[model samples]
Target: MPGRDPADRSRRRFARRQWARRWLAWRYLVAVVALVAVVGGGLWLVYFSSWLSVAGVEVEGVGLLSATQVRQAAAVPQGEPLARVDLDRVRARVEALAAVRSADVSRKWPDQVLVEVEERVAVAVVEIGGRLQGMDADGVVFRDYAQAPPELPRVETGATTGSEALREAALVVSALPADLRARVDHVEASTIDEISLQLHDGRTVEWGSAEDSELKARVVADLLAARKAQHYDVSVPGQPTTSG
Candidate 1:
């Protein structure tokens, strides 16, 4: 065939350019639609879908408390959106149990609420109303003991002893080293500032206040290792004294 006319070729080229422009416009619209669809789908799955809702609760770090008890305390809403669950509220509820010292609540994806609890550990035992109560290092009287354990030292509070005194006594007991603690028979607190420890070997340590407890413990340990005495006064750790 003879060479095509230049005008005819030019018109075809113009038409192709218009078509390319229109395709570009449609491509932008398609991309926007796809983005909206993805965002909407993600929102639905996270906020309203049953597939990601809570199906069960898992408990951990429970010793004194049963899993059932922790679950009941948590009260995590079943069938609720896991992403929408209030973890802080769940944690607060679980920690409200007297035996639970702290708790962590989290979502296990695809349908589980995870609750981890740190339970109170007894550092000493005290008698109240003819019943023995377990006291933690923080001086919290948490659990009642049916019978006091032989390894745990007892705290003896006199009529003048108040809550502060009990706390001071607890601090004193908690500050003792393991070997010293094992040797402790009982602690007596007449007031917040007057706390003493009686050892199994019939030796007494007069420890004053919860302040400077670490220093007092060190002094007591040193005195016991260097001397034999029925009485030790580390109330002033800087000037410790011992006498028979």
Candidate 2:
């Protein structure tokens, strides 16, 4: 009884080894659990937290359109998660504005969304119902002006704008030389084939169709140089005529 029994010593050694193995297994399990918790918390913080939520909106390339107007039109989800914003939907809404030619929406990260817009450039004006419509080269009546723009030529589209006749009128105005364009007072076209340019000097040009407009422009210059007529019919560039 004074010394430890061999069997008792062997049983104690086995118990110690078993306890060590259990401790090692528990350590591995605890480490794995902590790693999983850290990963889950990080993901939750990134994807669903206000730390990455949108806090500000930036609008660029706004000239004809006010920045406020663009922001209103964009209606980007305020305070939404930055990584979850629908950029394409915002872009489409911004482009729906009458003056916006195109739009690009993107996330600036952390807390901001940016919307960039390209506005339509007006080349002509049309008067309808006492309001002036600014017309781009594509014959789109984009915006209404309180008054007619003095610098741009006028297109007489009667009751409506952006019709085929309006397109012909736009083409005619866009093709004119700088000097000739400056002298033009207004363009009138009842039909696509009946386009005409009325000069600021009271001289009238009978431009028949949208076709051969460049050639007709050149021929009209030559014809006007040769005579001082109030009416010039250069619709047929090959055989032009002039009369009072």
Candidate 3:
């Protein structure tokens, strides 16, 4: 027993060192598993749990359209996690309405989705197939009316609604001053370069092309103010010709 004592003591120390290393390795693995569980649980709570689900929706910038209409159009996925809502799809649906010009959709966090929309405004009216369609500044026929609005100009593009002539006519109609615009009965354009305006009193003005339209608009405004002619030529605005 006395001769083998040092060998036994050295073996005990070696066995203790091996046990310590194994304990440390097991502790590290347990710590890593715990950390992963905590993070995964937090992510699931935020992304997939009903705690953050959309409980309601808010509609803004609704004028011509009722809040109910915009909300129905948006159709924000109710009871779904707010973070998971498809904003682009919601906006596209809202914009599909004939009255909406643009729309924005966003998550309001916790429990709501917000939808903001801009409604289209009529700059002119065009009669097609015996029905009146509202025309915006961009030449889009976005709305229809049972009867024509008295304030806006009537665009006579014939049966063709999508053409360069329609664009030119819309430009001319939108650029008129309040004073001149009120007297306009209708605007007729066969081509982009040949535009004419018919006043309420049966007077005609040749507005020519859309080029230099702002300058021509100003010139026409002044000439109409200073003269009363049956037929006025503002195609060459600088040197306008007039006849009764």
Candidate 4:
């Protein structure tokens, strides 16, 4: 075997040391990445853990529903992490409550839960069992009339409570002009084919059926505009017009 030069030997040792250093650096980098991943995952798991009790609850967009009612509706356990709450179930439960038109439930990170609700808007007063009750657009009768709103129209009919007649009456009331709307004393829908309006001004508007109420309203408005009329017959929209 040939003897190696001193300079060449030194150079070879230097290269081997450099290679070892590079290898150690790569290993250190890999270890650091793995350690960081483990720590990050642990932190995330701890933050989102369902077993953690909910620490906070925020209720928003509630009008008819009280904060206590909203909490009861959401049914989220206090001190439990938001991740543990069933958002869909909570929303469904809240919406099922009377006057709750809509609801949304969400998590607010770590330990907070949020709930939002929309309350129904009462449109008219409906007569049920000879008792006047407040009814919303969705045909939900939510309140018994101790005192009339005086602003909303009244619905009177022989039709059974919770019938389509009530719904039709609600639609008609919702379509009337704000000024004229308040003057409507009551809407009668004894027959599905016929609906009538009794104005507070002691005028009668024969608004047969809830169909084409906008057109009927326009025609009636025109008639009322043309002259001072005590009664209007809009049973036939464009065919024959009669007024008194």
Best by TM-score: 1
Give all candidates' CA lDDT scores.
Answer: 0.92, 0.87, 0.86, 0.78
Ranking by lDDT: 1, 2, 3, 4
- Model 1 pairs in collision: none
Q: Per-residue lDDT for 1-244 in model 3, tens only?
A: 5667898989999999999999999999999999999999988987899999999999999887899999898888789988889999999999999889899899897799999888888888988778899887767677789999888888887544356787778888777778888898999877888889999999998999777777777887777789988998889888888999
Q: Which model, 1 or 4, shows the larger TM-score?
A: 1
lDDT value for model 1: 0.92
In candidate 4, what are the lDDT values of residues 88-147, reduced to their tens digit? 888898888887888888887657778888888889987677788888876677767777
Question: Candidate 3's C-alpha lDDT?
Answer: 0.86
> Which model, 3 or 4, shows the larger lDDT?
3
Q: How far is candidate 1 from the true structure (C-alpha RMSD, Å)?
A: 2.2
Off by over 4 Å in 1: 1-9, 225-228
Q: Which pairs, if any, clash in model 4?
A: 53-79, 53-80, 53-81, 54-79, 54-80
TM-score of 2: 0.76
Per residue, candidate 1 scores C-alpha lDDT tens digits across 41-85 of 999999999979999999999999999999998998899999999
How well does each candidate superpose onto the true structure, as a TM-score?
0.90, 0.76, 0.79, 0.78
| C-alpha lDDT of residue 210 in model 3 | 70
Residue 65 C-alpha lDDT in model 2? 90
Q: Please list all clashing residue pairs in model 2, or write none if there are none.
A: none
